[model samples]
Target: MNRELPVFIRSLPLVLAGWVFAPLIPAHATELPLLFSDGAVLQRDQPLPVWGWAKPGSQITVTFDGGTAKTHASSSGEWRVELPVHAAGGPYELSVAERGGETLRVRDVLVGDVWLASGQSNMEFPVAKAQNARAEIARAGDAGIRHFKVPRSWSDKPEPRLAGGYWRAASPGNAGDFSAVGYFFARELRTRDSRVPIGIVDSTWGGSAIEAWMSAGMLGADATVAAEKIRAKGAAAAQAATQTRARIAAWNTAPPSPEAWAAAALEESGWAGISVPAQWETQGYAGMDGVAWYRKSFELSAPETKGELTLGLGQIDDSDRVWVNGQPVGGMDASWNVPRVYRVPAAALRVGRNTIAVQVTDLGAGGGMAGSAEQLYLRAAGGPLRSLAGEWKFRTADVRLSSTQDDINQVDTALYNAMIRPLQPYALRGTIWYQGEANAYPGAAFRYRDLFASMIRGWRADWSAPQLPFLWVQLAGFHSGGDTAGESPWAVLRESQSAALALPATAQALAIDIGESNDIHPRNKQEVGRRLALAARAVAYGESLVHSGPVFRAATFDDTKARITFDLQHSALAVRGGGRAVHGFELSGADGHFHPAQALIDGGAVVVSSEAVVQPQALRYAWNDDPKQADLINRDGLPASPFRAERTRATLPQQTKQETR
Candidate 1:
């Protein structure tokens, strides 16, 4: 057998060797994974691992940047070669060649810091939707910054390769689809070090939970069991999804004639009662994906009907077609977070008993009218706004027989199996995460403490980087402000996120001040990116600058006052608005009931006192779902994280009997 023979000639020996050896020679041609395609960015200053597929036992060689490495393909036809470490510069080419087989070459490859950005909707939010997106996109022409977005997928087990993806450089056309947080993070990094190329790998899914990104080994026994149960129904779930999509298609192409369901004259005896301004999943329609109908009736005076009116439907998930008294008013699709407002013509309204019906189609996850009570209203000319927040007649137009399509991304390890597992051991400078909104449910929020920490540790283990720097954005403020502060699930979830800092090289960026009360997805991603870069500078780059605001250190309780101290280094505690008084502080006495407290900065410490409490035993700051007025920041202008502290009663300074009196 000649050594330089063609692939077919070389395979003749294997074919004659036996059927057992024939399986080793891959049926397909030699190829590289999507990550190693053109325009890819490899992590610099580390051993570069290049991999691809070829005939089993085939000799493989990888060449890059004046260096070469050789290896042999495994029994599974997989081959990997490690090239010598390179510095942070390249627009070079990487080539993989198999003896007697095809040779693959990737162009425009760079060696630099590669950061993985992963999480839920916030991380997936595109640059086009961010604040000042148009200006940012126009200025996004940096060739040194690149992005690789992992396509959404799920599997029952670990996948050997990604479903599909491509590395795109930062430009006006490509940057709009880039993750806003990721784009800004990479942009800031390149600004700091222009000579070093920066790459961001974005792997995210909206409305996904933290557990969905973790492997079964990283999850608890109960969670693993639950995920297994879901996995058992994989085939049925797929069938249901296919059937449901067909049904939705049939309904969309051939809808009911005249849409009689939207008419005010339609009988409501068969419809079920459902509340507006909320997702249908939270109501009785959990785990349903497809179309649903909601109809609301309201009365109006003759003068109100005569004037042109505005119908505010708040936000609808996925898509919606709205009608006023059987007359189509408006429709929108794709933007689930945007509020929906329709104009009702004077002729479309009646003197009384007018009906507003909406047909909502949710491709997956949450559905129906999802908004705050204040966002649902009807405003008539020269009149006060009327509330449309009460119960409405609801009916299922179409739904998936199986709940799999709606809940697959939420299953434990499902996303990890497809989106994360295949990227293992890829050299990364660090990771940035923005999640927890999905895990803010009552029990899940509290359990996030252990789960989050374990997930970070598991990822580090997967990459063999014991000290991998992990940074995350704390859960931002949400919900309408009121007395809903005492026990907030969002606040608890934030605490869980902060608790993960107990791990080494871990940092958190506080976003409690930047969140929108009505919208879960905030557009102030610029600030979020800036804060994350600051953390990266301190943790990843070993910078001495202060990256975080004041953190609570200790607290002392005297007769009528509770003095609180903070761990402030290279910076001093200050009120955000230049006010001498500090807000967002609460005090509790022996009864364990918290009341608003007045806080005054006394030198380096804050002295808190409340007339409502005699002897303060506990203190809480920014402890609400929406801490709108929590205005405490360090001299660096970063907001302090929300916290709760209990007074050490044993360490309290004994007061004289008269002082107690």
Candidate 2:
């Protein structure tokens, strides 16, 4: 989104928590934070906080619409005043003035329902890469919808203000850079009620873990020591980041030419040998970031060269630019997880030797071409696929360590300190989250049950909105390999995410039916946004509609069968895809070994039974990493969330006389 900071902001001297100096204000000058600048959106129907820096003991006055507030600067030259609550309406001007000094005026300020959209890559995915993006971008000229993107930063302690950012109203040009999920969420809200302006505050980073977003205090016990270690590492990261930025800036001036690198005759004996379809981190280049070039050669038969050849490069981590036989075939700067399938024209193909070059840039976290080896191949006409799964010559063109290292944003409390803490207490109607993949490992996935709810409650406490609505996207399907009946980390994470629903005013949006098996970041975010909007309507707006599909209620066992009941709220149970028999049901006896079970729809319940099991003790639905056949949905077409239930002992009896009869 061209989030480059201004020279003044960039040159600010780094301090503890990377704080911008409050003592730098001129004696007669009153300077408000960047958040109070032009085009800012203040949360409506809440007490608005207007703050700034003035000379010590100086009287400050803030005026917006017909409301006025007065306060005196503290000994530290910091001052704040709260304006009266406002309704959802504005095009108003906000003025901050020193009692007898200069005044700063902000124009076109909006008062609306501001939603904090925070999470990882899926939430950070841009509209430019979403499905039907061209049409969506063309129609995104909504002045009523605005976005404020928080610049990526990290600190060990809370920072009082953002480094720099500005609000941009939705436009054809700007909307393409906006978070697709956030944009569509707001778009759906506008469809329901256009009376209030909608503002999306995007605070996100790709590949960030859940721990990175929480405050140290929120993590509980022994966190003091952990926070101390994180603080020390944060200092080291800042130093490393400074050096890395300088090197990157120097490299940007006159970086190595891609044409030379991609040239068919380019010398490559010095390049290192690396395996294809693997992240560079798994190779010898662990904890490395920045641009790298990969080159390989393949021999094509005469017939194979006649037709347009398709080159599949699996999926590059952050971005990639590809060239085949010294000609640019295709490239994309975003949607890192989407496979790169470039159509190689026959003209660019050769009967024999052909050189294919790919330049991959990893901005943060894991990098390089991932996905299965089968996905990396070449095909033409009716010919069998020629695998590109062997060794390839690789060379690092540039490197940045800040993003790949432990000292950066991945640490606990890092993002909370820099990105979220600064914006706290800024009234918001609610928050929407999309994360968990980073923490979805075997042992870590279970911890999310408590950690997630703690984070949610902590955020509510931070804002002093006890019943603030919180919604999150459940972990979607992706093939992370595990038996259907065995423990699946993704399924475990989904269960952990569902656990958060027990908290007050919370809802979950299911994406199990919409995720791609090969891609971690799915492109069908429109449906995700639609589901989240439905959740918002039910949780935030007091709507009585069925926002979710049938939730698992209880299970009862009768020697050979298990009857599963669901808490269907204003909806009837039905299997989607026009099939009568339900899928994704499993049964297990006292041995605790699960077997595939046939299921049938029985009015308000699903009866499951497996001939392989004599007595069912437990049952599970959609209990796989990728539940490809799970089709249970409400009449509203919303898919039911994954769940497991055990048979209540009291519901079963030892061969009763009636049963014997």
Candidate 3:
């Protein structure tokens, strides 16, 4: 591979990723930020920035594409030079040198459309971890797509740059660790225009809150939402969680010892048989909660056990602790969507049959491992790969709800100061967000409408693009997509997400149909990426396209029914899979209790009315955590955005409404 020309980049596998190793600045020397690295793709047709740190009062000079720029370092050692806007074509080098400062060289940088993809786990979900990743990875060689993964850090004050990270090109070796949503987004865009390069910066953290990504200045600017800063999570949850931790800790060391359930030679005659990689509930442990133990025995010859092995345990719901041959190898807590890849030392394995014991703690939903059998396997270092997903013995250890890990990232500006501010003025074409689950439960969702909007404004202001195209994913149907005919916080959060679309150059992608009933983080991220691409095409690229599905606009009521009109690109509203009727419509009269209603598509509107509601006052569509049958889609195959049309407040229930000062 030529060092001067950008080539396809394939990183080490997922089990060996997330550790960033890149260039850093030295004292009294001019150095580039982590964002400026080999294979970096700068936003074209926009004023580009060449910024970095140097000695105070130093004269800094930046040269790029035969253009020259100069600036003086401030008292705080910060300096920057703006590169005049240029066309979208580059395989160029940028050099920075100071009269009395260190010199730096950034190579193989491309000029193109740059998008910042941020949010929680689903957005951070990688292409290799997504569904059909194997096929995608096998053919995932695209030089036009570049990615810069921002390392995670939090601070009280704005940092000049990230600690360590680098720009990597999209290739099979490294593409799996790249954001699935981001990869698909760029892939779709590049397919439309191969000449234009697409650069996606993934600055995401799993389980992060919206408040964590909003600057304090922006949070303070919004008087309505700024007050929510004081609403930090309760200490009781933390205290109780600590106490529970102490108990669990003591129980683990209480002996009989750890071998009572872990020993390779231990008897398993009394344990029930269950398959690995499937939820226990489906295998006769239905609706059961608490800690459960799963043990499996596999034969490994002496040679096979001589070298270290990589254990691919997909994802364990909630938390898990694993042991091999009575030796504690590894475990994780709370962060469920992260695939478990443990490096098993050769010392932990021996000739003949070995026992693998896993204690899965189910805090919510159900216990056991949650993944397909195909994803559970073992690959010996430089050796053959074997499956570990056959019959296993399972026994319930406890049946109590585990303590919840209180969120510290919810601290007002902690995340924003550390994650967003440092990348300020990075010149982004737009942003894509996937969040709100944290703010969706326990009385915080009602305030998300304002907070979410403030976050967008704050990020845009930081980027210096007021009308930046912002696209977000509506919370997918959850809780099994079952009918929950009661007030739901997730539904409110989705509504809050929809509320942000009122902002200029913003769009929402409806995904009520693609969610997993048992899993909050859906693996079908290809659709998510494609939907966001549609939004980018319409809002960012200025294309006349049907990028969105039907959206509920207003409701016109009558004596016996409510003719609910909708807003869409066209008046062609139909079910997603060739069905005539759509579900998830609820109607309410003066009584205010919503009931499932018969929904009929009349032109661009979905006429909804319940037999019980003779005089309808309100109508709602797809207003539940998991609306499994909410299949109303437009001609472009986009699902309708969830909405609620409430004209009167007198009949509205008090439990569903929270008044924030």
Candidate 4:
């Protein structure tokens, strides 16, 4: 046994002695598990459910708010009793008891609004490093804002209750660990309605696909998903088993031969030159996969230093193995999603010329060394270190096998089974989502809107919260170049998102202007949260905020100009930053060809005209991948949603009726 085992054994007699001296402890026929933990905020105006497992036939009594309710445990050891709905007031205690004498008491319980916040990585992203993190963290000291994070687990079947979770107040100490977007949204809600305590049940998983949050029954119910599941199960099992074997083989494989590697290492003067931080695949090594070695030599005047040394290698596509002077130092796996921070020990350094070598492996798209612009330095005991963010020597190893056949679809499928099903029974105020970047590839995103709406409707049906407030984030601008427009799948996906807003109580956050061209996951999550909160206030709380940008209401075309009208609240149309020329408007004629058109905001509407297209059949605004010049903003400063207008399809009968009219 470990050292603590003896101490625990030694304390048993003392514990018994104390128990004997104290008043006799009551014994119960059945023990019951605790329901919501201490400080839990039960939903107001609804019968609060207090449940646990107890012995069969044992009577369980729950007392709260001057009322008592009793229920008997079933033969299966499950027991549930609901406390009568209490008014929205609390700072009280709740007690649950069995006739035989077991009792559980929770103190400081509150009755208020409770909501479940769940999604993939973006929802799971914490507040520590998000945009305006410091200010937000400092402002999260409100006691009314509470959060509970459900521990991650995967289940083949739905669970009645989560394994473990508890409520915690938002404070600087704990706020850093809370979901940034969720926290901000809740903060906004709490600030708007200070009397109502807001409880956020955070259940999210990073890098999880949408399918994982769907139920197995739901998946089986859909023909497309059913076939996809059948294909996915076999592929998933094979991939898991293969990965297991690969990990084992990696552990068992002998270390690379240092002597052979040294012999293979390029001579100092004869090394090939390459730019640092550029993708090797894009830089004349297209289709190349697996480990490619890069080396750079720098001189150090001092023999030894005390401070830390940091190496900045922009970002690597997949995995990388790095070394300093042929000594294995540090590395990273997965992808360039996370920045690499290596701390060099003083002993690892030597005076004069030092060779820094890196072996990069690209498992998939956009692989190789990246992120070279950040701080990469060799710091001394009392001084700053030298920077290493420039050119480096390079060479390719053996060609890598392409594992593109491995199905990435299994992630969503598995997540649906594990995380989403358990929360089906729990009532929620609404759902806020921030995803779709993962499916933004060509031909893959055409059905995303349908899939997204189906998932929303499916969730509403399952949870019985029909017409529940469902808000989502539109894909922000990303990647270099403007080619991701004009038949771009992302544009199509955005259109789909716009179409979803036609559903009841649904809204979309326009985020094109706030996105970074270099990073798909933008750091400006504050705006993301504020926008989501605005939608929730408008749709869920029935607040009169301008929760949406200008949605395309309708348009009438003349010989030379198209007159467009939109729904605006509290203000008229205004360009971003008060610009004179409204941007991102295009006019297309019957030939399906489009050209830039001059646009002007004319009080709650936009007028578009162009000499290039004398008769405009359709007009599109902010319809490209990166519309940096898109100046269509509401007076409230929210950017107008991206959209493309085409004639709606009418059936022959409807067309005949229109002709008759």
On lDDT, the leading prediction is 2
lDDT of 2 by residue, 451-554 (tens): 89999999999989999999999978887664334567677788888888889999999999999886677789899999999999999999999989888877
Q: lDDT winner between 1 and 2, please give it.
A: 2
- Model 2 residue 584 lDDT score: 91
**Model 1 clash pairs?**
none
Model 4 misses residue 442 by how many Å? 3.7
Which candidate number would show the highest TM-score if scored against the true structure?
A: 2
TM-score of 4: 0.71
User: How does each model score on lDDT?
Assistant: 0.79, 0.79, 0.74, 0.65
Model 1 scores worst on lDDT over the 10 consecutive residues at 11-20
- Candidate 2's C-alpha runs over 4 A off are 1-29, 221-224, 235-260, 269-291, 296-356, 361-364, 369-392, 395-407, 482-485, 649-661
Candidate 2's displacement at residue 199, Å, is 1.3
Compared with the true structure, what per-residue lDDT tens digits does model 1 show for residues 1-661? Answer: 0000011111011010000011133585687878888999999888877787788899998889878899999998888887878899989999888888788899999999999999987888888878999999999999899999987667667677777789999999889889899999888888789998999999887767888899888985464575575566565455554543443343332237538787778877867788888887666554455567899988889888787899899888867999989999999865576788888999998987899989887755667888789889999866899999989887766554322344566778888877888787678999999988877866677778889999999999998999989999998787733224346667777878888988999988888989988667788898888889989999999988888888777788877888888877678888988966999999999997899999988877888999999988888888888888798888788888887777774221222232222
> Which lDDT tens digits does candidate 3 get at residues 1-661?
0000111122211111111223444577777777888899999889998788888989998999999999999998889889999788889999999895457888888999999998876787778668898999888899889998876555545556675568898998899889888999899999889888999988876667887787778677553343344233324334444443333332322225556777777878867678777876556543344566888887787788888988878678767888889888889865455568888899999888888888876654445787677678988767767888878887765543222222434667655655677677788889989888777774677778889988888787777789999999998877733234556778878878888888999998877889887667777888988888999999999998888888767777777777766677754788877756778888887787898898877777677777888888877777778878688888877888777776553122233444232
Give the Cα-based TM-score of candidate 1 against the true structure. 0.82
Question: Can you give the TM-score per candidate against the true fold?
Answer: 0.82, 0.83, 0.73, 0.71
Screening candidate 3 with a backbone cut-off below 3 angstroms (N, C-alpha, C), the clashing residue pairs are: 10-174, 11-174, 30-102, 128-176, 478-625, 481-626
